[model samples]
Target: MPRIAYFGPQGTFTEQAARTFGDADLVAVETVPLVLAAVRSGEVDSGCVPIENSVGGAVTATMDALAEDEPLIAVAECVLPVRFSILVRPGTRAEDVKTVASHPHALTQVHDWIAANLPNATPVASTSTSSAAVLVQDGEFDAAVCAPVAVTHYSLETLATDVADVDNAVTRFLLVSRPTRVPEPTGADRTSLAVVIAHAEPGSLASTLSELALRGINLTRIESRPLRGQIGEYRFYLDLDGHIGEERVAGALAALHRNSNQVRFLGSYPKADQSPSVPSAKNTDDDYQAARDWVRRMREGR
Candidate 1:
C-alpha cells in the first residue's frame, strides 16, 4: 500500500484531503515537515501540503519546503474550499461553550464570531483545525474551529456552519513524491520550475520574464525567495502552462538560460483540468457567480 502524509492529528483537513485524493491505506502525520521527512526517509511514497489560500494567501512553510526539500517532486495539485464550522463535544451546545480553540488561520477566520458570541471565551491555538476537533473530541476544549469533515470524523457537534470570513475561501495543496512519475502526455499538461538568477546582473529579471512573453507564453505563477546570504540573491519558482516536452514551454525554458543562472524543472505532470477564467462583470449576481465559479474551480482541482 502506498502511504501518503499530511498535517494530521486524525481530523485535520490535510488528512481529509489525503484520504479524498488517495484510496484507503495511506497513513497521515501531524506536521508539514513530517510529510517531507516521511517521503525522504522511504516511510511514505507521497505527501500533500498546502501551497496557498484564497483568503489568507500563501502557506510559507510548504513553500519553503518545496524550495529546499530535495528527492521530492510536485506530482499533482488539488484545491480544497476552506469551509469551517464551530465544533464541540457530542451533546454540547453553542451557548454553553466557554472557550474555542483552533489553528491560528482558522481562529482569524472566525474572529468576529468569537468576539461577539463567545466574548469571554479564550482563544487557543491547537496545532491544526483537525487537531482542534480532535482535542474537543477528547473533552479538553469547550469548542473548536474546524472543518465540517472534522466534526464528522471526531463525532463532534456543529454549532455554526461555514464560518469562513469570505464565501469563497479555498486552499491549494500539491501532492509531492520522491522520483516523480513521468506519465506520457494526454494533451493537457503543466510544469513547475525553480529558477535562481545571477544577482550581479540587474537586467536579469526583465529578460527572465520578458523572454517568455516574447515567446508568447503565459505564466501561471512566479514566486521568489532570497537565498540565505550576505547581500541579496533570490530563487524564483515558476509554474507555466503546458508540459516541458512541448515546443513552446521548451523554447521558453531555453530562452530563460540567458537570464537565469540556475533553473530546476520541478516536475511536468498532467495538467489539471481547469475551466475558462471568468471575467469580472458589472453586478452583484455576476460577482456572486464569479466567486462561486472560482470556488468551484478550486474544489474541482482538488
Candidate 2:
C-alpha cells in the first residue's frame, strides 16, 4: 500500500485532496516542507501540497521546494474548489465575534466579505484554516475562516458559508515524489519545467520563450523566481500543454535544454481538468502517423 503525506492537521483542503486521491494510509504533517521532506526521505511513497490558488496565485513554498537541489517530480495534480466558512465555537453568535483568523491566502480570498461584514474585526494569519478553527475551539479567537469540514472536527458552528470573494476560487495541488520515471501520456497532459537563462541580457527572456512559441506549444503558465546566491539572476517555471512523450514537446524541450543554462524537468503528468476530446486541425495522432508513413515510403523508394 502506498503511504501518502499531506499538509494537514486533519481538516485542511490538502487532507481533503488526499482522501480523494486513493485507498492508502495517509499521514498528516503540519507544513508543506515537512510533506516534501517526507517523500524525499522515503518516509512516504508520495506527498500532496498546494501549488497554486486561482485567487491567491502560486504557492511559492511548493514551487521553490521543487526547484531545489533534491529534484522532486510532480507525479499528478489535483484541483479543488475552495470555500471558506466563518466558523465559531458552538453557541458563539456572529454578534459576539470581534476577530477573524485563517491562513493568509484564505484571508485574501475573502477580503471583500470581511470588509463588508466584519469591518472592525482584526484579521489574523495562522498556519492554515484548520489550525485557525483549532484556535477558535480552544477559545483563542472569536471566529475562524476555515473549511466546512473543520467545523465538525473542531466542534464549531458556521456563521456563514462560501465566504470566498470570488465564486470560481480553486486551488491546484501536486502529488510529488522523488524522481523515478515520468508518467506516460494521457492524451491530455501537462509538462512542467524549470529553465535558467544562459545570460542576463535584453531579449534573453524572450529568446527562451520563443522556443516554445515557435513550436506551437501552448504554455499554460510562466513565472520567474530569483535564484539564491546569484544576484539579479532568475529561473523560469513553465507549464506547457502536452506530454513529454509527444514529438513536438520533446523536440522543444531538447532545443530548450541545448540553448538554456540549465533545464530541470519537474514532471509530465495527466492534467486533472482535461476537457473531453475535441478534434483540431493543427495537430493530431493521425496527422503525425501519416507524416511518419510518408517519410517511410520515401526511404523505401530511395
Candidate 3:
C-alpha cells in the first residue's frame, strides 16, 4: 500500500480528506508544511493538506509551502463539507463547559454557535480540531469543537452536532507528491500554477492574463501571496479549468512562461466535482489543430 501523510493528529478534516483521496497507509503529521516536507524527503508517497475553505478562504500555510522549497505536485483533491461538533467527556453537560478549544479556523467557523450555546465558555486555539479533542481528553479544556470524526479517535461524547455559522461550507484538500508523471487528463480537470511577473510595471499582470483570455481558458481561481523577502512583490497562484495535456492549456502555459519571470506548474489533476469544461467553437482542439496545419501549409507554399 502507498503511504500518505496528512496535516493531522489523526482525526482532523485533513485526515477525512486523505481517506476520501485513496486507500493508503495514512500517517498523521502535525502541520501542512511537515506534510509536504515528508513528501519532499520521500518519507511518504504523498501528503494531504487543506488548500481552501469556503468560509475562511485560502489556507495560506499550504499555499506558501507549495510555492517554496523543492517542487511538489497535487495528484488528487478531495472536498469535504465543513461541520463542527462540541465534544466533551461523557456525562459533561453544556453548563459544565468553561473553555472550548479548537483550531483557529474551526473556532472562527463555529464562533457564533458557541456564543449562543455556550456563552460562558472561553475559546482557546489548538493546533488542530483533533488536537483540541486531545486537550479535552487530557482535561486541559472543558470541550472541543472538532469534526464529528474526531470522536472516533478520542473518548469523547458529542455535546452538540452539526454546528457552524454558515451552511454548506466546504474545504478543499490536495494530495501532493514529489514532481512525477501527471495524472491522465480527465474531461473535468483543473491545472494549478504559481507565477511571478517579469515586470512590476502597469499592465504586466494583465498582459500575462490576456494569454489565457485569448485562448478562451477559464480561470477558476486566483490568489496573490506576498513574495518572501521581496517587499511589495507578490506571487499569483492560479487554478484554471483544464488539464496541462490540453492544447489551449499548453499554449497558455507557454505564453505565460514567455511573459513571466517564473511560472511553476503545480499540477494538472481531475477536479473533485467532475464538472466538464465546454470550450468555445473558436478555441476547440480541432480549431487549434487546423490552425497549426494551415501554418505548416503556408510555410510549404501550399
Candidate with top TM-score is 3
lDDT of each: 0.73, 0.83, 0.90
Q: Pick the candidate with the highest lDDT.
A: 3
lDDT of residue 181 for candidate 3: 88
Off by over 4 Å in 2: 115-122, 201-204, 276-282, 285-301
> Of 1 and 2, which scores higher on lDDT?
2
What is the per-residue lDDT of model 3 for residues 23-58, given as tens digits with 9 covering 90 to 100? 799999988899999999999999999999888899
Candidate 1, position 236, lDDT: 79
Give the TM-score (vs. native) of candidate 2: 0.86
RMSD of 2: 2.8
Order candidates by TM-score, high to low: 3, 2, 1
Provide the TM-score for each candidate, comma-separated. 0.81, 0.86, 0.93
Q: Give lDDT tens digits, candidate 2, residues 1-302.
A: 89999988877788778876788898998888999999999999999898988877889988888888688888888998888889988787766888899989889888899888876678999988888998998899989998766766767888898777888888999998999877677887888998886345667688777877766778889888888788767888999888787766786789888877788999998888984222245455566577789999999995
The lDDT, on a scale of 0 to 1, for candidate 1 is 0.73
| C-alpha positional error of residue 20 in candidate 1 after TM-score superposition, expressed in Å | 3.1
